[model samples]
Target: MPAPPPSRVTIAFCTFNGAEHLEDQLASYLAQTYENWDLWVSDDGSTDNTRAILHAFAQAHGHTRDIRIIDGPRKGVAANFLSLLCHPDFPRTPCALSDQDDVWLQDKLALGMAEIHGEQPCLYGAQSVHTISDLTSVGRSVGAAPLALKTISFGNALVQNVVSGHSSLLNLAALDLVREAGVPQDIQSHDWWLYLLMTGAGSRVVVSEREVLFYRQHSANAMGAHQGLRASMLRAMRVFGTTYGAWIASNTAALRRVDTLLTPQARDTLTALENAPKKFAALKRLGVLQRYGIARQNRFGTAILWLAVLLGRC
Candidate 1:
């Protein structure tokens, strides 16, 4: 018997004034080893040559690749990606998210597809190599550590995101689940929300050991790459501030809207997190999170998470 045909992939790329490196990123897409893929982009009102570049590339490759460009919501990066994910025209195939400035390895799509094909409602992600804006090698992205399936859960996603959107691919069933949930207001990050929703719904989440892209860091990055002590300090500040609370509130509200979709265990964990902070003692809240197995990706990061919880910050 003959083998099945390759699964078609739809690459959802969100752009915002990424002209400086857009060509390289697009070129990398054209060089992908996977041939059965299309590109759909939503631009968030770029003032630079981003629109022109996309238009030219689409025109040049339209015969070979299905390329579509549309206007974005202009709310922010997360919103822009959500717009593409929820678009009515989005293909019902395996979908991958793309950053406007990252250079994808030739095998990125192929690798993701290979892992995600047999698993319905699955999410596939891998490590990324950090690079300077000029494509100069810096190092592997900080916390690009191996992802253990045991560590992936709605509880952990509530505290941290282990999945990088740029290197992630989701099967059609996962996409349908997200679209059914709809876009939430005040979402802190699209990738984090995906991780939460997928795991919460008892879907499979796979993180490959391979490195698949150059994660470019630049001045204009909505969230630049940060490593080392300085990065830790910055993360602490964010977790300890009112912003973290707001993020929690926003995510919790969204999760509640789709509460029925989650497994019983995940629903209970979400409820616990929602009610934990109401306790008068910070240590009590921290204990609640610990009981639910909420954790960050790394040991040091988990320590900071515990600290933040103890301070009534998480």
Candidate 2:
């Protein structure tokens, strides 16, 4: 059932030092076709003009029940975003996250709204128009329902980080699911964490027709493909072996301790880790994995990883 009347979706933005592209993002939101949404700007230790820009936008649209600037903790992106949801002013309202430097399409919220058929939070899967000078979509399609866990985990999610944080939308129930999932302060990215939480929590992740969000790229982004094959490969190796190994190990330990804390669904999802080691080892030992020119993202194998690194850039 779609939400009974009186419900609204909140568009929350978390800013660090995002002055350069903030105005562009604001303009995109201001032009959104859907009218039942609100804009929230939360600043996180920006020494730049992020505040001035957000304040000006809010000043004009704040009272219209469409925009507001919030003062909150300056922790990392994950923490800052949680603060946005936990803000007293932030009701148990539905929300969609926004990054400081991305451009949202006018129909971003409209499509998500159409999918809102119940009191359940509407969590969406977004397709990004990666603007690496020109727009190129990053991966394959998710079909009718983006949140289908079995299909997504089997390969849908394994192939690429298909869900863009800037491209998604969520509702209070979805946020509740996330909080119940207990995201760590040090998880990879908001999108990854959200993917894990949302899918694990049984929230629907839809791929909307809206091609909103131009994921901006510059050297400073935490991660992006603009680093080219060499840098991308190096980072991919570190993430796969050094960084991600440590991460999986840590999350495994935490998951074990918190097994009781998990929803039966979350427990089932995390417990599936029991098969990861054997699966990977079997693939390494028995599967006929072919050799390909290693891109930074090809985290194929440990030996292959070092070999690719030693080859002096892919």
Candidate 3:
């Protein structure tokens, strides 16, 4: 018998004024070891030559690969990705998220496909190699520590997002879970919401040990790749502010719409978080969060998160 055909994958790419590095990113797609994939890009009204570059790429590779370009929702990056996720023509295949500037390694798709398994609703993501604007290697985006599956829960997702959209690949069942949940309004980040929804619904999230792509960091990055003291301080401040509280409130309301979809434990945790504000003291709120196992990826981060909860910031 002939060898089994490779699993079909669809890449949901979102772009803005990314013409500078778009070509390099597109070229990386062509170099993928897994060739049975389609690229669907939603361009958010670019004034630069981004449209021209996309059209040229499509014209050249259209016969061999499924390359499509469509207008974005014109809201924001998260909205643009959400629009692509809900696109009528989006195929019911394994889907991966892509940024306009990141370069995927040759085996990125193959690695994700091998791990996803398609047995249940699952998400696959790997570490990325941080790079300068010119693709000069900096270091790994994440540390060498293995991701703890126990910490990969809705409770933790409510407090911190561990998944990077650019490195995420969702199986068909996982994709269906998000699609059925519907896009939430005023969502701060699409990847965060996905992490919440999937884990809340008891999906398996796999983090690969190998790095899968080069994450380009530059001045124009919406979310920079900085993880220094200053960056960490700023992030801590953001989490301790009213903005983060409002974000959680908005996300909670959105999750309520699909409350039936979440597992009983997740539903209870959500309820506990929502009710924490009613507690008289900050320590009480912290206790509630701790009881639910709401935590960040690292111990230091989790400590800061505890402080945020104690101050009623989260």
Candidate 4:
């Protein structure tokens, strides 16, 4: 079921070194089938042509959405996004996070906005488009699916993230939850932290396989398409032990910042995680192989996810 249009949204766009395709991206947004969005763009000190292009776009489409080009000191991807969310100019209702590179489908905004409404402050999901060696391959479709509530259960929520910063839409109420819980400014990926906390906070992480955004896989992508088993194993080994701890610590600190932003459900989730066994052998320490920590597993699955996480396979 395609979701209905959100009454309005303020699109938060962060760009750095995005000049090559900047115009294309802006055009896509301008061409959105659904209107009613203001654009908030922050250039992370791009030495490239990104600034000029954005300036031109704003001059031409000034009224498209209260376009504003602001100053950004290139904090980083995670921090940059945090700035977008916390920016005072952003509207208080529903907000959509956008990326500089991806091409937006015509109905992307309308489709994502529909699901973001309702009682729970839900997070809409995204589909990936694999660009292998310049070949753009079609992946997930954009047709809406029923938002699966149980998919984001507390225990299961601890492991993987469901929200894509680029394709996601966060409701105002969820903003309250996020503000209370505070995002870890110093984490591996901002979206992943949002996944764990928001899901645990009783927000629905709806997996809308509907392909609205074209996930461009290139040398610059933060995450790429799955590599072979050997590479995966090596990366998992690296991630589980030292890498995982460092990541958790960074994210934990970010969580502490937004501790008050947490909802009751989110607080309980943090409590469970904090109280879990010291070794954290379940999912935190190991990769998968428990009933719900990493990936629901027992003995064999644990080892499997362990290897996967270690090798970057997961």
| All candidates: TM-score | 0.94, 0.72, 0.94, 0.79
Candidate 2 global TM-score: 0.72
Where does model 1 exceed 4 Å of error?
A: 1-3, 147-150, 222-226
Comparing 1 and 3 on lDDT, the stronger one: 1
Cα deviation of 202, candidate 2, in Å: 2.6
Ranking by TM-score: 3, 1, 4, 2
Candidate 1 residue lDDT tens string, 42-81: 9999999999999999999999778999999999988899
Of candidate 3, the 10-residue stretch with the lowest lDDT total is: 141-150
Colliding residue pairs in candidate 1: none
> Which residue ranges in model 2 land beyond 4 Å of their true spot?
1-7, 120-122, 132-150, 154-161, 181-183, 222-240, 250-266, 272-314
Instruction: Give the C-alpha lDDT of model 3.
Output: 0.84
- Cα deviation at 174, candidate 1, in Å, is 0.9
lDDT of candidate 3 over 1-314, digit per residue (tens): 99989889999999999998999999999999999999999999999999999999999999987888999989998889988988888889999999988999999999998888856999877788888888899777553224543467788788777778898899999988888887778888898888888889999988776888998877766364535566677778887888987878888888989999999999999999888763348787888878998877777778887877766676
Candidate 1, position 119, lDDT: 46
Model 2 lDDT per residue over 191-296, tens place: 6656555544455666554456677655766463322455456655664455654544454454455355445855554554434333325443212112222111
* Clash pairs (backbone) in predicted model 3: none
Compose the digit string of candidate 4's lDDT tens values, residues 209-276. 67676666666773533334543455455445566656655665566566565667556555555554
Clashing pairs in 2: 1-117, 1-118, 2-117, 2-118, 232-296, 233-296
Deviation from native of the Cα of residue 144 in model 3, angstroms = 8.8
